[model samples]
Target: MAADSTRPVRIAGASGSVSDRRHAVSMFAANCGDDKVDVIVGDWMSEANMTARGVMKIEASSNISTSKSGDTFAFGDAGAAYEPTFIEAIEPALSDIEKHGIKVAVNAGASDTEKLAKVMTDLIKSKSLSLKVAWVSGDEVFPAVQKAHAEKRSKFENVSTGAVLDNWEFTPIYAQAYLGGLGIAAAFAKGADIVVCGRVSDASPVIGAAVWWHGWSRDQIAELANAFVAGHLIECSNYVCGGNFTGFKSLESKGWHDIGYPIAEISRAGQVVITKSKSGGGEVSTQTCSSQLLYEIQGPWYFNSDVTAVLDGLWFEQLGTDRVALRGVRGELPPPTTKVGLTARGGYQAEVHWFLTGLDIQDKARMLEAQIRHALRDWSDKFTKFEFTLNGTAGENASNQNAATVDFRVFVQAREEKDIAAARFLRPNIDGMMQGYPGSTIHLDVRQGFPKPIYEYYVTLLPQADVQHKVHLWDGQEIEISPPPQTKTYPAQQPSEPEATGVASTDFGQTVKGPLGWIVHARSGDKGSNANVGFWVRHRDEWEWLRSLLSVKTIQRLLEDEYRGKKIDRFELPNMYAVHFLLHDHLDRGVSCSSSYDFLGKNVAEYLRSKHVDLPLKFLNRGKL
Candidate 1:
């Protein structure tokens, strides 16, 4: 290997969330890889995380930690700073982070980069660490939003659906625009040891680190796209290293609990090598990389605030142990518009749960529902929603009493606080415990039946010219930025699935019906109101079988019970040998406001695995039955 003027920049993602910082540090401590990481990036701010932070900022100074006993929340200055969890998590490893001149880049600043900078600088000073901390701001566009609404009475439209703001039932309390890597790169160029920002795109830290190392410009479209692809690959940290992998069977259970985060070795010429720490326990295979490549992505053009990356013609190869090289990504000029995430109070929701054990569980649920409706008839109209779901069930069998149990979930959403009170939703169930279900029982968590504030999200787009991506240098110098010059034209194309490769007679064999997971692996996540699920097989020969079996109708049939009220779109990634489906509005109103059991849609794939599917005996057993 030849070394250019700029060495291969090694950028490693440490934590996907500030909350992950503590465990991430533990993972890092466990992996004592000799190679020094040039830059470490941490993404603590996510769209859902931002929404929760906004609501907490409105409700209280801090958020309550679920890891501890009831009701105690983490508090700081009311609106002055972000959650200090990241700061605290990194304190124990301050020495390690500054070792070998390893600089840190993170978007854990949440809503206030200024305050985060101050808090971090104070901590650094108190620790007497020789590290300079700089920050980037201007992701906040709430003032602009207010101005646009007040002055023009303009209705901000959804970027995906073009739905106007007036259609929303709630107004936003916080709005943040997506930022690019220029500010981060600028800060790093200015001799800063740590670069912090608020609401920067998740991959921006990696992009910035690469840009600073390579001295690349915004116009370096292809090069920046390479860095962008590398950043996107490792942005979720452990995802590239067998974490939540579809091909988990390929990797044994060893060291899985202590999965290592990913490290990207990128070249100035746009080559990428993804690997993990030698000491950490996890496999970095082509399958893992493929799985992550399609995670939460929609369509072909991989859009980031920095560049529009072309996923076509990309290649993945395993160079050596725990290393995979990704190359051949093309790119174009950045999009004219950037996404802005806004959050509002959606009102309140209350929930309660009951266990209907033994025989006639379904009948018991029906009776309980009928009685509740009759009792709350006069006041039932006040609620925005009233829902009941049979959580889990007992199969037909002769077994222990526990095997004969099923849970009934009673959920309600109301506009007025009084409409969803305990008296209205929770107590009404208590009245039925004796007279309704024969074997009714209560859960240990008595506090579940209560009202809680719900937050809603409204995502839209703003022209790049309207927002400023600026850097705040350590020495108090500010640099304003403009988008790169437009240089290419992207023709709109309709999305269509690959032509099905009809199965052959030789491929036919005895058929068996069982869980999909018996032969394939799956991963599910959320993209706002949409639920994204990707399924793949470990063997290349299984690709056709998997792809052919997972048509739009098949996926709909599998997820029909969970469908929220929209059509499902299926797309095939022949390169990755995977099938991806996006179920619109399946998450109800998205993370914060969703009344769905799986708001994040993280469990959608696992649920699909439970659905029985026909499997060719040759594919399942590689044998003639």
Candidate 2:
């Protein structure tokens, strides 16, 4: 890549800690560098998270009327406005933000972003800081989603099932389209120090910073793609910093409790090096960086609101200590359509736990199920879900009592919260206590839990032309961005067979039937209903063996019970010596709808790691290689 006429830019990642706000803020403050970081960005918005925010607003609204009489959890709108995660997380870092001249960006402003911006401004004013605050708007596409069918512009069809939205089981609240960095770029160009967006793509902040700092245009697809990858790499903060990493054994021994957020040094010439703070814990290398790069990606063509990047040729290089440089990122014109995360009030859900101890656990579970079925025989049809899961198995001759106990859980999901909460619904098993099998016991919350509302996410595409992308500057100037006209789509690609390895030329190391974790590091997560599990090694020697050992057929066999002949796509990243598998509908359904034990599919990799595989003795001896 030829050098552009602009200097490089640096940005820090500070979120994916929406719920861990205090730690996020503290880490952000600790990561500030007066002469290093140029922009700090984070994203806390997601389909499920936004829906949860709406529920909080409704609950807070209900608490309002009672607050006038006394102090209530419902402080009303004030409570709703109270310390939003996006704004609140930055409060402790305000001083460092100004001192270091670091511009901050975040999408923590879920549904009530206007209020979030206002609260943040007031907080800034109280501190007597002259920070310019800007907020991106026009993400609200509810009106567009409602008329999508009538206008013939978009369809909310289930990606896996081909089911249309008209026959959806629940009522939708609203739809928010994923915006790109153009809005954030506009704000930065207009001199806004802080940018808050509602549903901007997670990597948009980094892209926006690069655009502003490097003075790049929309046509700089390669540069944009590089920055986009940089943003994606660090968007989840500690993820690339070894949180939930398969090689976390090293970090744990190093006392990585105060694991620092990462900082990316990006260049105008398309070079990016990801590094952690001087005071942080955790290490950054090619392995960790590659794990996150393929975190939620679908395939060769990765789509963002701004650009469609090609990751098939991507590569990474470790540059001394805790730094890794991403290289060979390429991008094509973005699709004409943008993805919208639509969520609706699904209904309500509740659960009860029953502990069955000792032997004959299966019989006890059967006995319990029969009694419950008999009690709810007439009302069984009322619930959307009525399930009994055996969460544990009693160990043979265990040293501890808990090890001999098996967990029997009963869960119910219904349209009405109170219906599941009915005393008759919860007390039946308790009513038959004496008739219960020997060693039967109940946990503290044997009674059904309080009703919790549910939200089902429906992801669909909307024509970008229909969305009005606007950026509001602190000075009341709103900039409208025209959507790029180019568009395309990528159908699922089939997995290719691995290249045959020579068993004759090479010393095929002695094999031992042990856990796969003994040789390889893995990371897995959900992409809608699909589960993407990626495994990589720290050494070049283990690449071929790792890749050849975990082909699609082997993966299917490893996860036989769960996969059950599902469509799975395999892709390899030679740059990172990694192989990834995309198992379709393997999660049963998505987070809200999935009946699987691992809802988000985060444990798929760990479960596979525990599976007995023919581990290469040589690789095991070189441990952490």
Candidate 3:
């Protein structure tokens, strides 16, 4: 088929993560409204997910003991090292996909693209469908990384901490570099009906589908940028359709049990209108779109393996019910290097929780902590880290027992399993329970008291030229994809001051103090050891106040419990009426090994929203958020 530049390409997002809804593909394929879906893209790779999958592959490899070669993994075996959830999600939708001739693309291959492709092919053959399956490779670079480290070719410094691999205590067992979408585009062009990929960027599937549908060249930066933004928006499926929106309370009446996935009708000129199936639940309003836009992002420059999307001027306009138009997205060439995640064995960790009920909550917690510390004093030096955390406060004037109780958690991590074994770690906490404060009792669940393995995820960048990006067609033909001819080098750190949207000074007469959430909404998530929280206002007039009030210092003060002394970066997205902050090294290590209560940082925004702050009476008079 020749390219149709005039017709818009409709891409439906089926899955966001490895554990996303299993029925998403079937729902999108059968119920995507009047405009049929041309391509269905699922994003299954993340920093933590990659780390877990890498560990699985390294453990499964027999060559790990002999050649010291990280390359010889057991990826050829069926059901080895790939996300099985993807297979489950796609099998039920195959009939609809075959009926509608809908194309499928997903980064579900994890550490093994070839095996995933084989599984898909076998499934299609079993169903007697004519669909062709292709897989993109070159993401697994463990052997190459080890060689580079030994030869001192690259420092592989931690992108977050700037510490070189030389200082790393754990051995590098696995590594996978993020690949671009050009390989996917090639597979699609070569007549592939389904594309399986390893660690391509999350948005690469959508980008590749758009590039193939519209016949876009590499020089088409503006259009590619729009596709990149569209991919980012819908890549998380229901996320843009109100899954994690701050205004979720407003959607309760409509129901959230079966929230709809998103579909992007991207035009050849790079315009996009996001919508969802009429039969599914959830709203696709501007607020929902804005929430997804701010998620897991770093400042105004959103980098992907494909292209750099400049989101400062981006705006979302609600076209109607379940329809939001995204515009003003500009593009720049991709960065010279792409992110590579290296996984290693960090150690073992365990935690035990004790409930302190009724009077003298603080005193009870202090007493319990002192007792546990004294009990573990002899073996404390064997542990690498130890911390005591008090969660919640006892209510005043009494309520029920559960309502009047607080929890004290004792967490510890060690380099060796025996250091945190039952005798050394769990027993001390249990021994102190009888000698503890009044009404002291541990949680019924004892599973967490046992030490579990921890995998530390280290992120660094690798030059695009070093990756051997390739696509394998259904017929066994392999196509090599070259790096983008035009590329730009971004600064190691974001600019101290992003170009502000320059709002005119205005002052309302009186001010009232209340929770910031009274007039503002927020969304937040983790990126490695860092967390990004973006705050936005529902009303346009509140933009100036929001941007003015939320400085790095103010955020530190608001989130003082966890982010007080942390280095923070602030940026503005004036068009969205949002101010974003990136708190550095907030999550101890990444998700796999973090000991923070809010391990994924999903509650960072909610925590900030709960804090009281002075708000303009004019905005509060209009309505509370």
Candidate 4:
């Protein structure tokens, strides 16, 4: 029998990333109430994760070349090709899943879907559970990308830098297209109990599960858009339930030991109410939802493989404790292209750190840099890039020794391992300690100085028609999924800066200069080499003031010197009382190869919040943040 479409579909998010708590599946399965969970979705892949898996696959193949049998390397070997952690996460929950008749969807098949699917099927059999498993594939498109580039059909341009791949110096190894949810929906429609995927979009599983439960057709654009937003909100599991919320102080009393995962009660009318299990920790309020909504998004228009969500007018209401109703989301046809990530072997990198203590920290750093430079001058040209940075400043008149000490770092990258070897990189620094400035000492651990392999990540768009989306059922039946009939082409350039509105006047009476965090909350994340930071105020009165204060020029001025020259795009979300900035080429060559201290860009929001800005005395009178 089909599910009743009138009732809302309950979707639970179990895992946010590869490292998220492993027991989330069991927790969600065991905590169901009168309104049970219909489906569980887990997002377990990222750009860095793909690169690491690709490298592992390549290394495993290399090792197989010298084997006795002389057989080709097999991707079926789950250890090197897929995320084995998913098995652990779901193993204990099998009984609950079977008892409750719940469906499971996950993108844990990092590089190999069929293998993981087989493993899951065998596990189900071992438990004597009558569950059917399926897998989705064809996300890998390295050969197709190369062919397209060679035929001049596409340039495979870097989305962040606008650089053509023709001039790329690294050797390409892996490419995967972001697929839509229709494939997962197809598997579920065929009675699949568990669906595994490789490179589907992070939110695709939610959209797929919703589509399956509601029996939605391809033309249901508005409902699909709502599902897309719901997916994004809970895709990070605990994120929407105070995991990364700025109001974490409030959750400390509730206990952070078992922070809850998020659930979306999505209705056929496109309405969504976000909540969590009764037994879990953490609170769900409008502010927490706002934080998750503002995270990792580039602009007012949030693009997904299934639908393009117009988030400009999106708003939320707190109905009760741990329940927020999302509203006002609009929809459009998905963009003509879907994002694709390509990984390449960039080379090797190494770093070493030294402690600078007490007075003359600046002079001590300068002396150490000069000494290292002079020592390595003869071989400096061998390195592709070299950098010296003095991280943080010692506190003035410090009471503790740690407070009076700062770190000096030296980082280098090169084409060959020998160029960044410890003998060449760390020996000079060690020898200079005797003649170095007073109180100068290298870090106790020397492992960081050793060269390690790194992979460069590039993101671009591929036409939907180019992707070979398909689903493999447990019974060996294969289903091919076609591209959507409707898609709109959006301008490649960022949208024009939005004009400030709703402000009665620039003047807010009296003012006090203080950190922006005093009245604003923020969240930031990375997309390839680009980073997005979004700021939102709690009260409606602060909306106009925030819009007037955070212009593009002001943001550029506040950014670090290295990021000042990079291009930036700013957009507004009026309903959320928020402004967002997208910093391009901000993380070097993305997380796998970036040398930045904040490589993942998670701390960019906190850094921005720390910047001093004039605040309205009236708003400050309400209370300190």
Query: What are the Cα lDDT values of the candidates?
Result: 0.74, 0.74, 0.83, 0.85
TM-scores, one per candidate: 0.90, 0.91, 0.94, 0.95
User: What does candidate 2's lDDT look like per residue over 1-625, in tens digits?
Assistant: 1123366677878786455434555455555543356787887765456655554555565662321212221212335522265655688888777876778788877766777788888999999998889998878787888887777655577655456788877777667788999888888878788888888888899988888888888888888888888988999888888777877778876557867678888898768999987666888878788778767676667788778888877888888888888887888888787877677767676676788877888999999888777877777687888899998789988889889898887777777655666554666656666677786666666524545567677777788888989988777888998898665665635434443344223454798898888888888988777788888887777777877677788988889677777777787876677787777767755776555678878899999988898877887878632
Candidate 3 residue lDDT tens string, 1-625: 3346689998999899876878888877776445578899998766656766677777768433212212222222232578777888889999888887788899889887798899899999999998999999999888778777778889998877778988988887888888878888899899899999988888888899999998889989888888888888899988998898878888887778778888999898888899986666889988998888888687878887778998889889989989899977899999988889889878788899998888888888888888998999998998888999999988887658778888888999998878888899888788777777898799869768877777888888888877889999989899999988889999878854533346565575589889988888899988888888888997677888888778877887898767647678888888888888888777788888888888888889999998988888888888776
Which pairs of residues collide in model 1? none
What does the lDDT read for residue 152 in candidate 3? 84
- Model 3's lDDT to the true fold? 0.83
**Can you tell me which runs of candidate 3 are displaced by over 4 Å?**
1-5, 32-35, 63-79, 498-503
Q: In angstroms, give how far residue 580 of model 3 lies from its true place.
A: 1.3
Give candidate 4 regions above 4 Å deviation.
33-35, 62-79, 498-502, 560-562
**Tens-digit lDDT track of model 1 for 191-252:** 88888888888788888888888888777888888888888789888888988786665556
- Global local distance difference test of model 4: 0.85
**Every model's Cα RMSD, please?**
3.9, 4.0, 3.5, 3.2
Ranking by TM-score: 4, 3, 2, 1
lDDT of model 2, residue 14 = 78
- Native RMSD of candidate 4 (Å): 3.2
